[model samples]
Target: MSFDLGLQNTRALVTGGTKGTGAAIVDALANAGAQVIATARSIPADARKGVHFIAADVATSEGCAAVADGVLAAFGGVDIIVHVVGGSSAPGGGFAALNDEIWLRELNLNLMPAVRLDRALLPGMIAQGSGVIVHVTSIQRALPLPEATTAYAAAKAALSTYSKSLSKEVSPKGIRVVRVAPGWIETDAAVALAERLAEQARTDYDGGKKIIMDALGGIPLGRPAKPSEVADLIGFIVSPRAGAITGTEFVIDGGTIPTV
Candidate 1:
């Protein structure tokens, strides 16, 4: 079960590293002996030791470029870049619920950061002739939830397609690009949703959770995954041990995605 990454001295950049899955990935990379530069709009004051926190919003092209420059200046060049900074800004609505602004915001938040960062940093990785890139996508790309997150699903679908194309373009040059699609991660967001639903339904938090699960067709594992579980998959995918895993999607969803 040991991935045996031997990541000592390897430099990595993890976007959205202030909380949730991003924080978990940052911790995982640090534990594997990699020097990590974690970026977010604002870093937590009580952030863990050994991670260099950089204040930057990857949603902007300028911010992405600045982060890339800062990391290169500090670490010379990164061997791994984990794109974990995306999410939907749109509120709940079906197709008509999403306006142009919402569509643009979701695309920028969920898709553009990685595209911008790759444009800024992949050359360095290609020049070095070896690097790993992991894109954190969502299961929604395949299993679209139109009632609440149609725009989000569309944005993730674009991201998945872009990642696959980018991987094929870069893998021949000694850089590996892979994607991780997670389903129903147990994060603060989930907790908030549960609380909101509980109050609306006049039920307990667990009851709200059951309602959510039923909506998702019941997660086969009977629970959402922890952030650390997704992080573990990310850690392995970016390691040398997973060199042959480029241009593929790894779904860590507890069988929530029914398709083969």
Candidate 2:
């Protein structure tokens, strides 16, 4: 049996689509026959087929406007928006280690981009009276790791809450807003961190990865998730088949979160 999402001709804008989970989401949407407009700070040299690449930094209001304007001009209007542009620049150290500047940066990186994009594009979606918005949050919102990412956790918590509230207001108006929270995805960053930990601890990269997983209390599935796995869930949530699902968060963590 085939899992047909029936998203042909749908136009989607995926932020941070240059790499990692965002790239995977773009691929999934394209595979489902959606016309994908992917934005990032830089476009990859060997870009995927069936997806248009736009260069813009979503962390700034000007960048968000440029991307929205570009997409509107190219596609006329967008039917789906997947906000996957967020990360913590905070280095290791607890809350006190993060000063005011760092806190502001974290908030902007992890929260404001989505806010600005929604502000810019929601009017178009509202005018159409139908659309889907997916915000990629982190599992840190529920399981915060204060050792290095207190601000990141806080910002994602705010993003999740904002998504829920936004969904409530817009679901009655024919737009769906949802959140996806992923944990310890095995992306390029994860590999690099593991290698760095290995160098610091005088161990192999695989050994360092084991330490990291152990620190996460051991993933029940005995592994971190691939970016593609998270993308699969994203594709489902934004598809018409999931029309009844809105205003909620789906956690894809390989059972690492240890909660209901």
Candidate 1: regions farther than 4 A off: 1-3
RMSD of 1: 1.3
Models 1 onward score TM values of: 0.96, 0.96
* lDDT score, candidate 2, position 70: 93
Q: Name the top lDDT candidate.
A: 2
Local error of candidate 1 at 171, Å? 0.6
The whole-model lDDT of each prediction reads 0.90, 0.91
Clashing residue pairs for model 1: none
Tens-place lDDT per residue, model 2, 47-143, is: 9976889998777888988998998999988899999988988988797899999998989888998999898889889999999999999999999
Assess candidate 2 and give its TM-score to the true structure.
0.96
